[model samples]
Target: MLNTACLRIHISARTTTTSRISKLANSASLNTVAARCSHHAAHYDGPSPTIAIIGSGPAGFYTAQKVMRELKGTKVDMYEQLPVPFGLVRFGVAPDHPEVKNCQDTFGDVAASPEYTFIGNVNLGHDLPLPLLAKHYDAIVFAYGASKDRKLGLEGEYKPHIYSARAFVGWYNGLPEYRNLNPDLTAGDTAVVVGQGNVALDVARTLLSKLEHLKKTDITEYAIQALSQSTIRHVHVVGRRGPMQAAFTIKEVRELLQLDDVNFSPIPDELFPNDLKSLPRPRRRLMELLKKGSPPKEGASKSWSLDFLLSPKSLTWSSSDSDKLEGVLFSKTKLEQADSPESKVTNTDETTLIPTSTLFRSIGYKSEAIPGMQELGADFDDQKGTIRHDGIGRVVSLDTREWDKASLYCSGWVKRGPTGVIASTMTDAFQTAEAIVEDWKKTFDSRRPVRAGWKGVQAEAQALNLSLRPVHWSNWQNIDQVEKAVGVERGKPREKFGNVDDMLKASGASG
Candidate 1:
């Protein structure tokens, strides 16, 4: 259901290789061709401006592509905490939605340019202090993305069988951090997901999908085994608001409805507008589809639903086991006006209990302050889950004393809260690049002193004893092939290596 709008976004945001002795000979030829190409780029032909853009996700890559295309003598060195790149596209996209991952092709094109460089496996503010970047690069773009998840604060939310959507998505998608989640899906047949976002739907779809559907995807082998043994049958995606205010896109909902042998319980018509023509095109289509629902096939084996206008209060425990989840207690909510997007909700006297043994908290994702942010004179807004910015992408200090026009900035989830899709993220990133390019031109002509790109940064890193072992584009290409070869042997699209050491070893990344 990922439609043409997403493809158009790709068109709007439209923006690597080999080999030793034989590799060295190939390397030289490639270098010669690259040098010739760089000289001809028309924009990046002169001494390049050093720009350090942290994080290699869509934001960082798209920003780099736009900057390199718009500015002459501009070189970008992308820094990633992991040896692999394409942050969420690699670890957050649902395994079955291979179409959404198509943006990787555009990112790949950006990385192939001579003006662009890949520096992976180096954690900013940790492996090297953030201030160290100031001395080497002319500009620093923080795009590390959200590293933490928002919690439900419910009393028993941490008990066994309760997981955040990020962890669940990460577990199946092979994120190194959540590889050992090993959620107990056999506890019961019913599961409650406390959110109505696309992620919640993805979790529902994965749980209810046939094992055959998952086996052919790029999902981790360990997750494949875990899901194959799941006892899950029903999924309830609960939300604080009614259908009109739901955050999920029509494509995600349509995909779930179309799943083989999976049943979608219809959404109540009372929650929707009386006249469908009153709603926008997207919402009207979505509401109509939801009201019609997917009637289960003759012998459908599993089912899911959109449980709306319910505010989760707490997780109830089973009588026999205190640590195991049994149900979610929700307070019924009433809409203030209902048909408008600005409608608000308030708790009502009614209450409902959903029986379940497994739970997922998918309210939303929150971004954390990158370490060493304060010493650089920029502060992270704890309340907003973002860095303090001018709302366009510039990191500014509200406190007059700390302000230095710091030339420090951020984009993507770290700058704005994590919300949009790849296409949306691309739009956000391109805007950030515009801001950056505008600033760079003015700064380049000013007395900001002179600097070398990554070369200068590497020299400073060595002097600072940062102990950084970075992976380049070539290394990623090698590790990529290794992962694909492994996948081919197992009959899947690709099998991800879920550990940092394994990827570095596969890349043969040297100090």
Candidate 2:
């Protein structure tokens, strides 16, 4: 459990002293200062530019960081629906892969800055409407990631036992939405995860990790208990295309191969050629792992198998139970060469079936249209399932020759169509900030100063009947302290509060 002593202390009293520096100078210094002043004044004039970033994820924090760094004296506020911050890093990354979550440290640093204010438990389109934010802030950046999952679009895809990789990963990672979602893992010894990607690996690893092994991590108590009772033995990671086309990274594949008691085997040599060419480096490494077999002296309880060049056609039930999944029917496929008929590779479509109880599809992620956004004259691509943006992450109107609106922008998965690692997301955010700065430089005179503080904003929100219980930055530090204390009491890592109410209560928020 997390040590309570290690958690940082929380300070609740607000200080009137201005810790932040003001770049606003008198009009007399306007000779050369006018140019630089013009660039910086858009964010500082009248009331500080009330910029609201709509997510608390990596993209949102990084965007806030870059914007505040570039635009002097900007009162940048970030809103998140979750009680806590660090979206995927806190709730999506595998528990064992703590190193990947170092991004949270960077986010913590950004959140601590006086220039940034975090308002948690505020859903953008719910309690806070996009239109309201548009009217309130000079610029509103939507960094809400793709919260929805992609479907298989296959027969029986909606089978009760068949889960979405997003939900499965969320369940193990203690996402509040899926914390209570404990699927029947003991139904069958064999399991199948459709679609080859890092998400698929994450699902498989969570299903395979021993309860004891997970105890040391920050996995929720409920998740730990549920996984402790899982009876899964074999996990088959199936992909529609050949290994070369799989989306999983080399590092993830290596990690999976390193797991004890998990054995990885590929298709027969006749199915895959020894001289397979033009394969990506990650796929090649996966092939090498397959040939070498399991590592020496590993766990003896569970194993994972890899199947490529197969597409799920149907999900067949073995028993009469409507709530349980039985098996999956698959269609075998072979690679085809684009050049000539006599080429080494030729198209081959063979049919087959694999038996399993659990199935997870990890194809990809898609964004959903926010309510009132379209009503506010926002353009979105229905086919692409993302907001329509220019090359620089500006929301473009169909009638306008270019994006002239100063209030609307985006970052993260929503900006770039749900791809790339956290590092890549940071770079993408900086680019988006650059675009915001350029646009501000072009149109500086129109923006007005914002006059609102935490107290004033809360009072206004209350007047509007909005249940605005914001988890201030210091409040998070309190929750962090209490959670770690609870974890230490239980001799485990941090134990998250099951719901928002508990989190707020722990943070000393008044009823």
Q: Highest lDDT: which candidate? A: 1
Determine which window of 10 residues in candidate 2 has minimal summed lDDT: 8-17
For each candidate in turn, the TM-score is 0.89, 0.83
As for candidate 2, its clashing pairs are 1-491, 1-492, 1-493, 47-449, 47-450, 261-299
**Global CA lDDT computed for model 1:** 0.78
Q: What TM-score does candidate 1 reach?
A: 0.89
Question: Which portions of model 2 show Cα errors greater than 4 Å?
Answer: 1-48, 270-287, 295-299, 338-349, 397-406, 446-460
Error of 1 at 413 (Å): 1.4
Q: Worst lDDT window (10 residues) for model 1?
A: 8-17
Error of 1 at 442 (Å): 2.1
Best by TM-score: 1
